[model samples]
Each structure stands twice: as C-alpha cells, then as structure tokens.
Target chain A: MNSVAQTFSTAALQRNPAWAQLLGLCPLLAVSSTLINAIGLALASTFVVIGSNVCISALRRIIPDAARLPCFVLIIATFTTMTTLVLEAFAYTLYIKIALFVQIIVTNCMILGRAEVFASKQNITATFFDALGTACGFTLALVSLGVVREILAYGTLLAGAHTLFGPTANNWTIQLMDQGLLPLAAYAPGAFLVAGLLFACVRTLRSFKKIPPPKSQSLIQD
Target chain B: MADLALLLIGALLVNNFVLAQFLGLCPFMGITKGYDTALATGIATTFVLSFSALCAHLLYHGILAPLGLEYLRIILFIVVIAGVVQLVKYYLQATSPVLHQLLGIYLPLITSNCAVLGVALLAINANLNTLETLIFSLGASGGFTGVMVLFGAIREVIDHDDVPAAFRGTPLALVTAGLMSLAFMGFQGLAG
Candidate 1:
C-alpha cells in the first residue's frame, strides 16, 4: 500500500479473508496447528492463485465471452493439478499433511474472485502483482495464526521446521514454555481465540494511526 | 434412529458449522449484519450446500472413482454446482420472485463457497454409503443453517452493544464464535 503505485491498499490487502472478507477460513484455523503446515498450504495456494490469475488475464480476450466462468475453472483446475502433482511428488511429507486442504484450495473464493474481478479484465502484469499482494496478505494472516498455534500447542516456534524449511532449519525452533500446560489453547476454541487476539492487535494499531476502517457495503438487496 | 439422531445433533450443535467446523464463513460474516437477510441466505445456502454435497458424492464415488478420475473431482464438482445454481435460479425465477430477489448474487456465490466442497470432501472422506452421505450432507447443511441463523441473531444483538473499540467487528464475532465453539464442545460426549 506504500508504493508510489496505487494498485490496492494494504488494509484492503490484509482484511481477514477468513475473519473479515470471509473468503478462505477452512484451512486458516484447521491447518494452522503448526508453522510448517501453514507455510506449505500458503505456498501451494499462492501458486494456484498466481498461476490462475495470470492465465485468466492472458486468455480473457481469446476466451468466448459466454464460457468465461467455465474457462476460469478449467484454468484453476489445471494450476491446482500442477501444484497438486508437485506436492505429491517432491513434498509428499508436507503434502500428506495438507493434501485435503490443498485440494480444497480449488474451492477458495479468493482465487476465483480474482479470476472474476481483476484477471477477467486487467492485463497479466497487474493481475500478477494483485495475486502476489493478496497472497502476501494471506501469508501474513496464516503466519500469525501459525505462530500463535505453534506456541500455544507445542510450546515452541517453528516446532516442525524440518517439514517446511528442511533439515537446515531443524535448529530454528524456540521453546518458550514447559510441556503439558494450557491444553485448551491448543484446541479448536484456541484457534478462534488466537485469531481474535490477532485481529485486535491489527485493529489497535490501525486505530492509533487514525485510519478509517472499511465500512460494510451492501451490494445486493433483499 | 439413534445413530441418525446423533449425527443430526452432532452437526447441528456439537460441531456447529460456523463456530467449530468453520464452514460457509463468507455468508456467516456478510449476512450477519442484518437478521432477515441472514436467515434468508442461511436457508438458501442450506438448500444449495445440501444438494451440492449429494451431487458431488454421486459423481465422486459413483462415476469419478470408478473411472479413476478422482483428480478431476474439483472441476467436476464445480461444474455440477454451477449447473445446480443455474437450475435453481431458473426454478426460482419461474416460481418465487420474492425469494429469488432475496437470494440475489449470493445464489451464484454458493458455487464458490468452501462449505459445499467441504461437505463434499467430508462425504468422500468418510466413504459413507449413499444413504448415509445424503443424511450427513443434509444434516451438515441443516446445522449450517441453524448456526448461521443463530450467529446472525447473536451478532445483531452484539452490534448494538457497547463493545470496546478494538473488539468492534470481526474480532468480536470471532470471540463470540469461540465462546459458541466452547458451548458446542459441551455436546461432544453426548453423541457417543
């Protein structure tokens, strides 16, 4: 949002896709139990988003106007298959941990949303940046949840570093608490609590800076 | 009867769609801004999600798996959902203009909803027979409706309350959902 270019606001970027925009929450709380899992999911999702957006943007003109939505799904499925194949082949360890959610990425509105909104209209370069920005926003949210879950659940940061960063990061974990305390914080309700706290931290920072929060807009009427 | 009852209660309360399973969140946050629309959207989504789950299950297990086209399930499911949404739209246009108006853009958005796919995936994961999958999908959708309506109603009440500044919107909803999740957790041991 700070660039000389004004593509999209960071606030717009960082609005909770799960908690705020309500776009992709299934994996947000579910796969976030560990940093490595969350990071792997984020990478796979980002790859799909970017690949789909770019293809949709490039093909917008040549595609029959009527088949736009169907074409977009085909594009997304192709990219998803590509990402899925790579995950299944090389990163089977992380892949197994996240396979279902990886496939679920095909269902994420965030990907189809850009396909419908930006990529369907804009050029590839702009769509590329847009996906990167949105994925960064999503990654920011994922990593926050990951940090909270890893700390509360496992008493350490990067507790399963080998799964994500490979053996090189086996030394990166930092244990901050003793074992077997605050068991509830490691569970589902805890995911909700940590997400709430993270939202508060962002809101507090936004308020102190005096930025206006985006008010709810009703696009459809009953 | 007992197993069916357990599945119904487990989905409807213990594993309430919004708070615990985290399904259909877009509608949960969007429709909750008002009471009536939330109720309408919830009902509409329940109809679509339940049906989509059924179709996805039939296609996934009955056709795709048999042909070893499981890799194509996502696209196939989306295709089925899109077709279903259009059919529903046409049917609504023919019969209930008021309800059609109420559904608005959300009808097509249903195809993109993760809940439908989540239900589909859960159906395939459990590898349930047709009867069980239908019951589970319907139960999950029904539970989704119940939770969306409840959350929307509670959120309407919370919106008027004097919440702290930092806890104003999504944060507060999430916290309320967390508490609701805790409440739902109470239903855990009841089913088994």
Candidate 2:
C-alpha cells in the first residue's frame, strides 16, 4: 500500500468518486449548501481532476482511437475553462455561487471517468496517482457534503471562510448553532435530504466492516 | 403571450430542471429505477434536452456570438450534444425499434447529462431570443419530462415498501428524491 499512501487512501477512502463512483453527483449536490461553497467547488474540482489527469496521461500516445472520446472531451473542456477563469478571478463571491456548477465541470463523469478509467492508460506517474486518487475522492465528497450541509443549514462551520480564504480569512465563521437550525438543511430539498442521509451514513458504516462485497457494486454503498 | 406564459411557468414550475437547478442529476438518479425505463428515460431526456436547446440557440447566437467563440462554448456545447445524442440514437434505431430497445445504454448517456449541458448553458445564459430559445428549450424539456414521469411513478411505489438494511439502494433513492423535492416546493409562487 505504498504508491504514495495508495494515493491518499484511494482518494480519501477507497474509490470514493463522490461516495464510491456515484461520480460527481451534479457538482456534488449543487454547491453543497456552503462550507465556503464546498471548499470552493472542492478546490475547483481538485484542479480539474489533477489537470485532466496529467494532461490525459501525457497525451496517451498520439490519442487516436477515433479521436478518443473527443480527445477526452477537449481535455476536460480545457480544464473546465481553466477552472472557470480561476473561479472568476480569485473566488469572486465564491464565483457567483458556483458559476453554473463551475460550467457544469465539463460534464463531470468524474472527469471523464478518470479520463476513461485511469488516464487513458496510466503512466505519467500512474496518471498522477489516478488523478490524485480521483481528486481526493472528489474532495472527500465535497468536504463531507460540505460539512453536513453547512452544519445542518447554517448553524455554521466555516460559514464563509473569507469566501475561499482572502482578506485575512475574515474571522473564519464557525458559529455552530444559536438556534435549532434545519432549514431543510438549506434547500433544494435539503440537497436531496443531505444526499440521502449521506448515503445512509455510508451504508451504516460499511455494515460494521467484515469486508468482501466489492464486485460490480452500486447499491450506492449498501 | 405574457412572455410565453412566463417562460412556460418558469420551465414547468419555477426553475425546475430536476428539483431546482441541480440539472440532470445523473439522469435524475440514474434513469429513475423502472416505470417503463422511467418513461423511456424521460422521453430520451426530452429529446436530448430540447434538441440541445435548439442547437444551443443556433450555435450560440448564430455561431459562437459572432466568432468570439465564447470560450468555445463548453467545447461547442459538448460537440453539439454529442451530435444530438448520435442523432437520437439513429433516430430511435430507425423509427422506434421498441424505443431503440428500451433506450439501451440510456441513449448514449444523454451526452453526459448535466441536464443536457444544463439546457444548453441555460439557453445561452438567458440572453435567449430565437423564440425565447425555443420556449426555453420546450420549457426545459417539459420540466424534464415532468419530473421524470413524476419520479418514475414514485419509484414504482417505493419498490414494494420494505426498505431497511441500511436504507436499501442509494439510500432509498435519495430519500425518495428528497420527498419529491418537497413536493416541488409547492410550485413556489406558481410562476409568480
């Protein structure tokens, strides 16, 4: 388990491209209510999935296979328009509340499903540790669903960390509850009821562990 | 007519495209479990999201806003919504060979559905004109095929109500699409 701590524990815990391959759940439930807009669109989709998985694994040999999925979607739409012009020049009000989910992160099928399953065909340092373990498992499911929907809708937790840290991180707001919060965990049906109770609390903590399940998974953690 | 009935009741119930702009939730919770393949994957994602919003409003105002190439309009609206989902899967495999065999491979994954590139980048960022971008892409694909056939007929009656063992399947289909997005937030202000 060495490949750089198996690329940060296979991106913040075994293959969690947003809780185990539910790939970018629409910008992980739209700008995750806030925890500085889910760590500024999870650090601009972990810098466009590790700069389009090391430039599609150093242009995986003259990219032919019938123009490889439109050249890995034009190198993940030119790093999602260079991460939406560097989040509209340094987090301009959390880039206007996540500029259309940062230009729909060029249709985030988890950055073209890690540029068609592990950067075209791995190399450039195992396609930069499978794009830094699938962008640290999609920034640990957008910072743990933006810290449980900003601590159940604005009870507060890094309430607006100086809109992505600037102006001396303006008193980094963490005022956890002065009242019984739960304003539907801040709308859109409380980000689908806190992403279905955070995938039923990671399928009841991976059913108390005794491992083994794997194989073509998806009961989404069940 | 009252601004196309307030842009077709603001895209069939105030800004809906899958419960208030979460835009095409990976084919609204993966081809909404059953109900005739969720009404044939919501009528093949309402004909590739209103024909990629009338060809991304005539190729972003008659060719990428007069060749400024508006930052190559998200790589030319994902190569013309993957060539209009391969011309609606060879025009539904030559005129409905049983809905091209019940939309296999969810009709070319509706060209990577971010709700068909969020209704062609919200009809070219709502500058909209050509008949209000084809009535806001036929009212956002008739409100995404009326909430994917009302969340596929309430996920076929919650797949015979049982649901335990760590809230079976995608946590009971994302808590029944968060109670049908809180009954579509009571159609908020019913289009003002």
Candidate 3:
C-alpha cells in the first residue's frame, strides 16, 4: 500500500507534466480560448494521455526498434480516431469547435513525450499513475486559464457550459461583469499574452529558488 | 496578381505562421536569437514548406481525399516531409556540410512542425482544387518565410536593445509578436 502511494507521489513530486517540465502547451493554449472549449479539451486530452499510456506500456516490448516511430503514430492515431468518434456521436457541438485540435492531440508534445519517456520505461500500474499525475496537472492549468479568459472575455465564468456539460449546465454561467467589464480578454492575443505572462512568472519563480552551485574545488585546491 | 499580393501580405504580416496562428512556435522561439541564423533557418523552412505544401496537396487531392484515404493524411505527410528532409540532407552533406549543420535540427523538426500539418489541413479545408492548393501553399510558405525572417531580424535588435527586466527575452519576443500581429491586422482588409 505504501509503495503504491509512494509511486503516485513520485509522479506528483518528480514528474509534473505542465509546470516543472513545460510539455503540452499547444492544446493547452489553443482550446483555452473559452471555458467550455477548455473543459472539453481537458477532458479529451486526459482521456487520450491516460489511455495511450496504458496501451503503449502494455505493448512496449513488442514494438520494434526500427519501426517504433511509425508504430507510435499508428497507436496514437487509433486513440485519436476513437475520441473523435465518441465526441462526434454525443457532444457534436463542442466537437465541432475543437475540430482538428482534438485530432491534433496525437501530436501534443506532452502526451507523446510521456508515452515515450515514462510509460515505455515503467510498468503498467506506475505508468497509469504517472499519466494521471500529468493529466491532472494539465487539467489544473487549463481550468485556471479558462476561468481567467471566460471571466474577462464574456464577463462570466463557464459562459457556455451547456455545450460540454449538457443542457442541464445552462445555469452554470457565473456573471463576473453585471456591472461593466465587457469585451473580456478572450481574443487570440489575450490568450497568447496571458500564457506568455504565466510562463514568465513560472520561470522567474524557478530562478529565484535556484541555488548557485558551490565554488569549484579546483580553485580551492593548493 | 492581386491574389498573389493578398497572399503575400496575409502570410507575411497577418496570420503569421508563428504568432497569429500559433504554428511553428518551437523553432520561432528557439532559433530566432540571431538574425543571421534566423535567415538561414528561414530560407531552409521556406524551401521545405513550399515543396511540402506542393507535395502534400498533390497527395491529398490527386490521391488520398478521393480514395477515402483522408484518414491517412497525418501519416502520409510525416512520411513525405521526412523524405524531403532526408533528400535535402543528402544533397547538403555532399555539397555543404556547413549548410547542413546550419539547418540540421530545424529541417528535421519541420517534419512534425504543426504549421506544416496545419497548412496541408488548411489547403484541404479551404477546398481548393489542384492549382489553387498549389498557389495557396506557395503563398502560405512564402508568408511563413517572410515573417520568419522579419521576426528573426526584429528579435536580433531586441536582444541588443535595452529591454525591461521583467520582459527580457521570450516575454519580450512574444510582446513584439503581439504588436506585429496587430500590425498584421491592418492588412486583413485585402481580398483573398
């Protein structure tokens, strides 16, 4: 039991997919243009990343060295196709906006990177935990950015929640601007600027914690 | 002639491959520190992008889309782009190792560059015929090249110029890109 917890924490502490590693920024920023779009993307990517990790890890040994890239391509394509079909059948409206971006999840650096880096190297159980850790990290970032963009751009949070969460979520909207803040920062430029600023903040905080290495022993040696 | 001009302006300024569309950000930020390097990279990208567009279009229209092979695009494109990069690598090694190294990484990276994939996808999405797809890709690649070189030059100056502490490097480049996107917005009035 302790080992299982240890494994999960190791992924949490040591293998954060979004912040510490900076993987998967494409869909992270692209679909983040709206709250519903962001939620839809987060759910889709989480599904792909977790599913692919498990499948790929299961077949890790069987995959040939010479044909690995193509093999990975084939695997990711199947998963993407499955997700696209599922979304099309049930969530047609949200799926339309996401369009190619959902299929493009196969090309996402973080998802592919994790499959290649961690999942291939670890057992299936550990791989699943690692993928979950990363997906949760990514979902956190996407939700935070979505909240900011939705509030600013539409003067409400979860402005189109019904699109993803269904008709019941029609009441999900939170009016952040009943008083006056229309034309919120939901445009393409705003997304880029916000993402850029977020990246800078993280970089700054990282450098602040960075300890300067001790003086070289060569200089100290007689 | 008017269409060409529209293509040029739209690609070079408006709808920049890097900033506006969010395509090709990997190399845009990675290789734009120096104008000289950026120019070389831009030239190489322009060549590959133009040809990739041409080839990918042919495969899409003449072959894939008709035969119910549209699902095969992502794989087919990677295959063609990788093949082109390999052929270019062979030519460069025999002739100019310096040029090969100059574009060594970005050339291969172009295979998976979302911009390339986005271009092929756009060509199909725009539903252009054979010739139209060719023309569009040429324009798109040209625009990609133009903006790449221009952004590269602007970044060079920014690197030397006094920049704010908070917005020193990537932050400053992105802010510059945002301003440039606004500049490009001025040209959106042109006919496609």
Candidate 4:
C-alpha cells in the first residue's frame, strides 16, 4: 500500500511526464490553446494511458521481448482509436478541432515510454496506480497550460465548455478581460514561449528550495 | 501546377511541420545538440517521411477506404510506418554502408516521430490525391529538415553563450525555437 502511494505521488509530482521528463510535448503544445480542447485531449489521453497500461501489464508475460514494441504500439493504437471514435460520436465539434493530435497519441512517447519502462515489468495493480498518477500529472500540465494560454489569448476561461459539456455550459465562460492581453499566446510561437517560460519558472522555484533533482530515468533516449 | 506549387511553398514555410505546426517535436528537441547529427537526422527523416506518406496514401485509398475500414487508420498507418522504417534500415545497410552509418541510428526513431504520421493523416484529411500527397509530404519534410538544420546551427552558437542555470538546456533551446517560430510566422502572408 505504501509502495502504491509512493508510485502515485512520484509519477504525479516528482517525475511529471510533461514538465520534468518532457515525454509528450506535441499534443501538449498543439491542443492547449483553449481550455475546452485541452480538457478534451487530456481526458482522451488519460483514457488511452490507463487502458493501454492495464492491458499491457496484464499481458506482459506473454508478450515476446523482441516484439514488445510492436505489441505496445498495437495496444496504444487500439485505445487511441477508441478514444477518437468516442469523441467523434459525442463531442464532434471538439473532436474536429483536435482530431489529428488525438489520433497521433499512439506516438506520444509518454504512453509508449510507460509501457516500455513500467507496465511491461510491473504487475497490474502497480501499473494501474502508475498509469493513474501519470495521467493526473499529464492532465495537470495540459490544464495549466490551457488555462494560461486561454487567459492570455482569449481573455476568458472555459470559453467553449459547451462543446465538451453540452448546452448547459454555454455560460461557463468567465471573461477576464475585454480583450486578450497577448494575442500571440494563441499561436505556435506563443506555445513554445509559454512552455519555455513555465519550465524555467519551475526550475527557478526548485532551485530556491535547493531541492536536489530526482534521479528519474529519462523516457526518451534522444 | 499553380496550386501544387502553392501547396509546396505553403507547407515549406507557412505551415512548417516543426516550427509552425509543432509536429516531430520529440526529435526536434532531442537530437538537435550537434549540427552534423541534426542535419543527418533531418535528411533521414525526410526520406522516411516521404516514403511512409506515399505508402499510407496508397494503403488508405486502395484498401481501407474501399473496405469501409477507415476507423482502423490510426493502427494501420502506424504499423505501416514501422514497417517502412525497418525496410529503410535494411535497404540502407545492404546498399550503402556509409549512408547507413550516417543515418541508421535515426531511422528507427523516425517510426515514432509524430510528424511522419501527421503528414499522412493531414493528407488524408485534406483529401489530397496521390501526387498532391507526395508533394505535400516532400514539402513538409523539407520544411522539417530546413528548420532542423537552422536550429542545429543556432544551437551550436547557443552552446558558447552564458545562459542562466535555470534556462540552460531545453528551456533555452525552446526559447530559441520560439524566436524561430516567430520569424516563420512572418511567412504567413507569403502563402496567402
């Protein structure tokens, strides 16, 4: 039980897939322009990560070491497809906006990295907690970036929640300003800048506390 | 001809896969420390990207769409891409040892590069024909290589500069990329 709790917190805060490890930046940067899109993608990715992690953990013993990567890709792709179809059927509007990014989640490296590093070796119970924690960390990153970008670009929070939550959320938008302070925050350039600054801020804060960096294994080999 | 030319130019500049569209960022950030390796990886990526895009287009149009198996695209495209990367690896190993040594390490990495899959899916989504898909893939990958080479050159310069501890490695690189992206945004009107 203690180990499970440790795994959860470690994945969520210490070794965050986004900020610290830099596992899945493609979707992180692309779909984070709006709060609705970010939430939509985050939910979809969370579903994929947990689904694939559990399945891979359950079947890890049977999967051949030589063919593990192909097997992992297949499982991730299946869950990604399921997420794509479900979103298309229910949230067609939001789905259209982020369809490409959603489909490419199979290649996000974060999911595949977890499968290769954690799920393939651990049992289903540990894998489940790890997946959950990683998903939460990814969600935190995406939502924070979404909130920051949405506020800077559109001057509103949850501006289009209706697309995800249906007609009731039409008024969920909270207008923070009459006009967006920095329209550039809505585009690709703004994504890199904001993400860079965010990383720098986190590093600065960590340095202030003089916390030694965690010895987390990097998911990507470069 | 005019439209294809416009598509090429648009993809190469206005909708660059790396700087502007935010695809293939893993490799964009990962293997960009040295100029020689970066350029080699870019060239290798360009080759695999165009090949996989062509194969994906044919597979989708010839097989999946006809059979109403379009929903299987995400799975099929990835599998096909992985296969293509393997084929390229072997063909390189057998044919030109020198070229293989230069690019072999990067070939496998291309299988997971989102930009390759992005081009395939984007072409299918835009309903481009075979020729257009080929051209678009070339343009997109060309843009990828161009930006990668440029970023690599810039990184070489950045290494000597006195960057702060908090922003030394990836953060600094990202800021440089943001500046490059800003510069690329100026090409927006050129395509329009």
- Judged by lDDT, which candidate is best? 4
Cα error of candidate 2 at position A97, Å: 29
lDDT of each: 0.76, 0.79, 0.70, 0.92
lDDT of 3 by residue, A104-214 (tens): 676666776677767777899888888887778788778877877677677777777888889999998888687424352565566667766765665576568672322
Residue pairs with colliding backbones in model 2 are: none
Q: Which stretches of candidate 2 lie over 4 Å from their true place?
A: A20-23, A27-51, A56-74, A78-123, A132-198, A201-203, A206-222, B10-15, B24-59, B64-73, B76-117, B121-131, B134-177, B180-182, B185-192
Candidate 1: where is the Cα deviation over 4 Å? Answer: A1-22, A165-172, A214-222, B1-3
> Which of candidates 1 and 2 reaches a greater lDDT?
2
Kindly list the per-residue Cα lDDT of model 2 for residues B81-167, writing each as its tens digit: 888888888888898798788875687777788878877787788687778777877788788877888887888788778878777
For residues B73-147, what per-residue lDDT tens digits would candidate 3 score against the true structure?
766776676677678778887999988878776676565556666776776777766666666666666766667
lDDT of model 2, residue B45: 79
Clashing pairs in 1: none
Candidate 2 lDDT, A1-222, residue by residue in tens? 487677656655666777765777888888888778888888888888888878988988989977688788888888998888878898788888788888888888877876776778878787777687778778777888888888887777887688788878898887878742787878888898888888888867766764333444322110
User: In terms of lDDT, which candidate is stronger, 1 or 3?
Assistant: 1
Model number with the top TM-score: 4
* DockQ values per model: 0.51, 0.25, 0.33, 0.71
Ranking under TM-score, best-scoring first? Answer: 4, 1, 3, 2
- Real contacts recovered, all predictions: 0.59, 0.68, 0.15, 0.79
| Candidate with more favorable, higher TM-score: 2 or 3 | 3
Evaluate model 3: give its TM-score: 0.85
True contacts kept of 1: 0.59
Quote model 4's TM-score.
Answer: 0.97
TM-score against native, each model: 0.89, 0.36, 0.85, 0.97
Interface RMSD of 1: 2.6
